[model samples]
Target: MLKIGITGGIGAGKSIVCRLFALLGVPVYDADTRAKWVMHHDKALKQELTEAFGPEAYTEAGELNRIYLASVAFHDPQKLELLNSLVHPHVGNDFTKWVEANQQAPYVLKEAALLFESGSWEQLDEIIVVAAPLDIRIKRTLQRDPHRTRHDVEAIIAKQLEEEEKIARAQHIIYNDDQQLLIPQVLQLHKLLLSKI
Candidate 1:
């Protein structure tokens, strides 16, 4: 089984690309969603969070306190790194188990916004980067998140690896700009991956 990492900057339409892959019967593990789940259910991770961020890391009902954690970590780079350090390992372990369970799959996608930043890309067999123009990405993000301003979106884009960098490192690239038809690009990649398998 091939472990493929799908990544792009915020608003680059990575989710849309991943959904297309899922439609083709590909096993897609969304790292962000799984990270949240692991943070809530993994006992060791919960203890680490509590120790790092104090008891407010989770509520009495054993739910992660996102607001509290964000407030404590977001403003401090060191705190944010510590948080990622704690969570990434658990997510990696979870991904390993998920891959084991899907050993029959030809390829599996692990979609994450920070695949490279978290160093998870090192574990994948290949990487597919979804790319789009900055203006288009900002517009898409604003449309998807009504509460976020253009500045907020731009800030996020700034924090991510540059589009040129991601494209240079990726084994495949799917353009999501309005000018390109996404389905065909995805289909072509799907066929190519199938051939490889």
Candidate 2:
């Protein structure tokens, strides 16, 4: 199966584009959501987290203490890298199983906000970047996240690969800047992928 990666900076409408692909019967693995699940359920991952961050990583009820984990890792780059090192490998393993289960698919999409940053793009056959103007992206994010200010959105964008960089690296691009109609572009890509199959 062709493993396609769909990535974009925060608020670039990656999820919406993935949803369009999902409608066409393509299996979509949402990396962020699955990563959270892996962090909470993978035994070795939980053990590594406890070792790195102490037992406070999980609560008495065996649930991941997100607040505690974020407090320890969010502000410190090294701590955050440690956390990702432990978590991403498990997520990658889970994605491998997910792909096996959907082996008959013409293509499977792994949608991630940090596909390039996490170095997961190397595992995929092609990458589709969903792009929108920075201002438009910020506006969309603000509308979606009511509590986040423009500065908060900007900070997130600053951490992600620049829009130009993602576009330059992508094998396919989908524009979600509101001026372009998204479905036709998605359909075109969908047809092309099917033809490749």
Candidate 3:
């Protein structure tokens, strides 16, 4: 089975493109959602996180305390890196098992917001970057994610690879700005990927 790594910066429409792929019958593993699940459900990880971040990592209901974790982790770059260090290996292992279970598919997608940043692109056969103009991206994100302030959204964009760099690295690019027709672009890529081995 061919593995495709699909990524884009926050508010870059990566999830929309992934949805289009799924509509075309490609399987997609949403790494961000799975990572959150692993954080709450992985017992060993829970123990390690508690040790690293203290018992506040979980609430009285045993749910992961994301706000508390982020408060400490995001402020301390080293802590954030350490948290990712603990989580990513488990996510990688989980993806491997998921791929093994779906060996019948011609191709599968791993949709992640941080695919390139975490170097997970090396594990895939191709990278699909969904992109848009920076201002459009910020507007889309602010509209879609009401909880994030404009500055909060901009800070995320500032941390990611520049649009040109991501575009240069991608084997495929899906333009998701208001300027393009999304379905036709999706269908074209669908046909193209199906033609490949």
Candidate 4:
């Protein structure tokens, strides 16, 4: 089975494209969702997180304290790197197991926000970078996440791999700008990927 990576900047509509693929019966391993699950369920990883980020990493009920972790890590580059270092290996191992289970797929998508930054792109055969104009992206993000201000969205974008670099490294690109029809682009890309295998 081919391992494909799908990535893009914040609010670039990676999830929308992945949803289109999912409707076509493609198996998608959502790294961000799975990372949250791992941090909550993986005992060793939970212990490691507490050690690294303090007891507040988890709540009294043992749920992952997302707000605290974000506040601690998001503002500091070193803290963010440390958090990724602790979390990503566990997420990677989980992805390997997930891929094993979905081996019958023609191609599996590993959708990650930090595909390049976390160095997970090395495991994929190809990458698809979703693109949208910066203003559109920020607007979409603000709409989707009511709690986030424009500055918050921009800060997240600033931390991600540059758009030009992601495009240059990608094997495929899907333009998610509102002016274009997303369904057709996704369908065509789907057919193209299936043809390759």
Candidate 5:
């Protein structure tokens, strides 16, 4: 089965594109969500995270204390890298196991916000980037997450790779600015991927 990595900057609509892919019968693995699962349940990962970030990594209920870690990691690049170094390996291993079990899929889509940053792109046959104008992306993020100020949303976007860099690396691009029709783009790619196999 083909393994495709789907990535985009914050509010570029990666999840929406992945949802369209899922509707077309692709097995979509959401790396961010799965990382949360692993942080809570993966023994080695939980231990490593606790060691790196201290006991505050998990609450008394044994669930990850995301608020605490986010404050520590997001403000410091080195701390973020350390966290990824520990978690990405486990997420990669988990993804491999998922592929082994879903061998019948036409193609498996791995949706990750940090596909390139985590080096997970090496695991995929192709990469798809969903693109939108920066202003639109900012607006979308603000609307979806009103709890975050525009500055907070923009800061998050600033941390992700530039759209141009991602575009250069992408094998496919989905313009999801709500200006172009997405279904046609998706249907076209469906045929293109089948030809690859």
Candidate 6:
């Protein structure tokens, strides 16, 4: 089965594109969601997290403490890198197992905001980048996340791989800019991928 990595920066409509693929019966593994699950359920990974970030990584009830981990890792660049180093391997392994279980599909999508940054793109057969203008992305993000200020959204965009770089690396591009029709673009790509298999 072909494994395609789909990535875009914050508010670039990656989820919308992934949803379109999912609607076509494509197996889509959302890396961000799976990473959170692996961090909580994988015993070895849990231990490694505790060891790296101290016991505060989990709470008394054995749940992953998102706030604590974010506070510790998001602020310090070194700590954030260390955190990714620990988690990405486990997430990668999980994706491998997931792909094995999903072998019957024509293709599978590994959707992640940090596909390239996390090094998961290396394992995929190809990449699809969802693109939108920066201004539109900011506007869309603000509308979707009411609690986040413009600065907060910008900060997130700043941390991601540049839009141009992502587009340069991709094997396919899906434009979600307001002027374009999303379904037609998705259908075209869907048919193209099916033909590839």
Cα-based TM-score, every candidate: 0.97, 0.97, 0.96, 0.98, 0.98, 0.98
What are the runs in model 6 whose C-alpha is more than 4 Å off?
none
Q: Tens digits of per-residue lDDT for model 5 on 1-197?
A: 89999999999899988888889888999999999998999999999999999999999999999999999999899999899899999999999999998899888999999999889999999999999999999999999998999999978987899999999999999998989998899889988998888
RMSD of each: 0.9, 1.0, 1.1, 0.8, 0.8, 0.8
Pairs that clash in candidate 1: none
- Give me the overall lDDT of model 4: 0.95
Residue by residue across 1-197, what tens digits does model 1's lDDT show? 78999999888999999999999999999999999999999999999999989999999999999999988987688998999999999999999999999998899999999999999999899999999988888988999999989987887787688998999999999998899999999999999998897
- Tens-place lDDT digits, model 4, residues 124-157: 9999999998999999999999999988988999
lDDT (0-100) at residue 126 of candidate 1?
96
Q: Which stretches of candidate 2 lie over 4 Å from their true place?
A: none
Colliding pairs, model 3: none
What is the Cα-based lDDT of residue 124 in candidate 2? 97
Best-to-worst ranking by lDDT:
4, 6, 1, 2, 5, 3
Q: Provide the overall lDDT of each model, using Cα atoms, as 2-decimal numbers.
A: 0.93, 0.93, 0.89, 0.95, 0.93, 0.94
- True lDDT of residue 149, candidate 6: 100
Better of 3 and 6 by lDDT: 6
Error of 1 at 171 (Å): 0.8
**Residue pairs that clash (backbone atoms under 3 angstroms), model 2:** none
Once fitted onto the true fold, the runs of candidate 4 whose alpha carbons sit more than 4 angstroms away are none
lDDT of 2 by residue, 104-173 (tens): 9999999999999899999999999999998889988999999989987887787788989999999999
